[model samples]
Target chain A: MVSKPPPDATRRSEKSRRAIYAAALSLVGEVGYPRTTVEGIAARAGVGKQTIYRWWPSKADVLLEAFLDLSRQAAQEAGQEPYAIPDTGDLAADLKAVLRLTVDQLLDPRFEAPSRALAAEGLVNEPLGREFVTKLLEPQLQLYVDRLRAAQEAGEVRAGVDCRIALELFVSPLAQRWLQHTGPISYDYTDTLVEYALHGIASQPPRSA
Target chain B: MVSKPPPDATRRSEKSRRAIYAAALSLVGEVGYPRTTVEGIAARAGVGKQTIYRWWPSKADVLLEAFLDLSRQAAQEAGQEPYAIPDTGDLAADLKAVLRLTVDQLLDPRFEAPSRALAAEGLVNEPLGREFVTKLLEPQLQLYVDRLRAAQEAGEVRAGVDCRIALELFVSPLAQRWLQHTGPISYDYTDTLVEYALHGIASQPPRSA
Candidate 1:
């Protein structure tokens, strides 16, 4: 997650926020959600508990925002927009490019361990699960939805297609594969998903015989 | 969950095992996986903890086997064999039938909370995730692989298709929807997934221009 202020924010606050973000992610990964506490994050960040409580309401909120900050920072470092997937006009190419970046993120040790911890915790924690889904995951998914809607308008996708559900044809495979270790992630795999998704799966043409 | 066989011989012991299965399932749902214990299950089932331990190793194992048993019983109750997705030779109908059953299971209160707990644990615990996937999940997934391979032989699916990835097109979407609350799940959704998967998303037909 990124600091909310503009790039010109005080170096000290930026450093402290970064420290808190790192502390929040690392501690949760190490001890898990149950044992992870606000005090622990503050201690590890070299700040008072008030610093965290002042910023976020709960441990879940802190960690959620921390992940968002991490993602934004990671995207910026990659020279990509923090939120949007590349359009590139060609849907398949754009999808492949975005999924490749996703592969890198999923395989990154810094991102991997902490993400897995939170995701696992979300499986059982309903409120946290919904919060993470709403604040963090769904917004990212909506980006794909936007791109697909663009494709549909461009006539690359059939007019009758449900952009929301259609996006999942490819998107959810990557998600499940990563979340469940159901399979390996690769450019070839993602590229195939994008290709398979844009066209109909039946031997016939799209939307008709 | 099924009734366990008596240690050596006894009609009444079989009844106790069934009671234990029902108790374990109900307890895990009501109290959740973490709060559920051997003692709680024993007291609820009106059996000694030793009776449970004599049959299963750990609480996780108990819940896991209990789920497996429940699935079998549910399938049998539906008048079908457990683990076999009917190959009535209409691939789409078979998949839809199985997925509908999955929807029913995912929605079942007896299955919901405990399954969520196990799934949440699986996200972080690779060993447990792999164990359950191998024992409880992969076998189910393989049925789709087999069906796809059969479709390939019959010219229902493209000969070039990878059954593993092909199945994910339909399977992962339904899973992502269920696990993450990404979208609404319905027979319509599953039917659409099967159609999308068997064909693909390209603008052109798979066979030729």
Candidate 2:
């Protein structure tokens, strides 16, 4: 168990944390990762450098936490539970609904710029990339895995299929389009992805095979 | 038709071009996009800065052509035609074979460093990303589209399905695994992607619907 801070002190800490997150995200978005500095984030956040260091050890930590917070807030704003994919038993519909939310998050201006900056940095910075993926992305991916496992047990997915790789069929296409600007993204597009992933592009015979 | 240069002059130009490509790729791979310069590439290539400027207008142009040349050389060395996916009337086999080659290319040290450097830069640099995609990636993707179109005509694919999007069900998964290091890539992995893509991930019904 941990001791709680008094109300006023807690409020002050919360305010500082929010400011720091906003500053870190915006600064990284504007300047790109290499140019973003802790001092700069501190200055922009209007908090002393010590205040930031006391909470987070490195700029990467601050940014990572900031991103996590932002995602949680985005999920809340979208009326989504941040931790789990909804399981309605109708797998395609559930997957489509959740992916539509992802489409919204990806398109949201607040999320887009900073996420792109960080993703670009991650491409070359392997340690940071692995850290962010392990902490942030892999967890989110695991939600899909859990959902897929449920799907497998329900006899929706094939028994031998790796749920991890199976999830990528629908997920990575949207990611590639968004990251590489390979194509336009929309609810319709993602819906098509889910459908294609479920039923496949091959011509189905008149009867179930 | 264009006039041919004298044989000796052409040979000298070819040598210079190869040297410039090597210099550009290695320089970008080592120092990254922002720091790679015409002067630096020329110096490394043992050619005058004028030679580089005369051929390519900017560092981006140089890098783009260098990548295109490298890809062509890689494909040729792998015994693949530079522009087309093979069609042996077996869609799954052809896609799997092409993807296996991609797995090899992705793992090759000669391709990995420079491609990652450029791909990282492309993530942040929108215009360069679009330009490279248009000149290099889109053409490659079009080959898949064409193959899928052929598959559609042969009754292997559903006629109404979008070939471009269908191709992503396999291609983007491999790409994401390679780009994000989300998973290990291998021939077996790609072969599985072909299988899952050709058939859906969902358990097939006793008869096709």
- For each model in turn, which proportion of the native inter-chain contacts is also found? 0.63, 0.68
C-alpha-based local distance difference test score of model 1: 0.81
Instruction: Look at candidate 2 and tell me the lDDT of residue B111.
Output: 84
Interface RMSD of 1: 1.8
CAPRI verdict on model 1? medium
For model 1, residues B140-208, the per-residue Cα lDDT tens digits are 899888877887787666657677887888889988887877778898888878776765544445433
lDDT tens per residue, model 2, A64-124: 9999999899889989899899999988989999999999999999889899999888888
C-alpha positional error of residue B23 in candidate 2 after TM-score superposition, expressed in Å: 0.4
Q: Specify the poorest-scoring 10-residue window by lDDT in model 1 chain A.
A: A200-209
lDDT of 1 at A17: 87
Cα distance off (Å), candidate 1, residue B170: 1.6
Tell me the tens digit of each residue's lDDT in model 1 across A1-209.
96576666567777888999999999988988888999999999999999888888899888988999989988987889989988889888899899888888988888988998888777767778788999999899899889988887887766666777888988899988888888889989998887677654444443363
Task: Tell me the DockQ of each model, to 2 decimals.
Answer: 0.59, 0.63
Weakest 10 consecutive residues of candidate 2 chain B by summed lDDT? B200-209
Output the TM-score of candidate 1.
Answer: 0.91
Q: Which stretches of candidate 1 lie over 4 Å from their true place?
A: A1-9, A206-209, B1-10, B30-36, B206-209
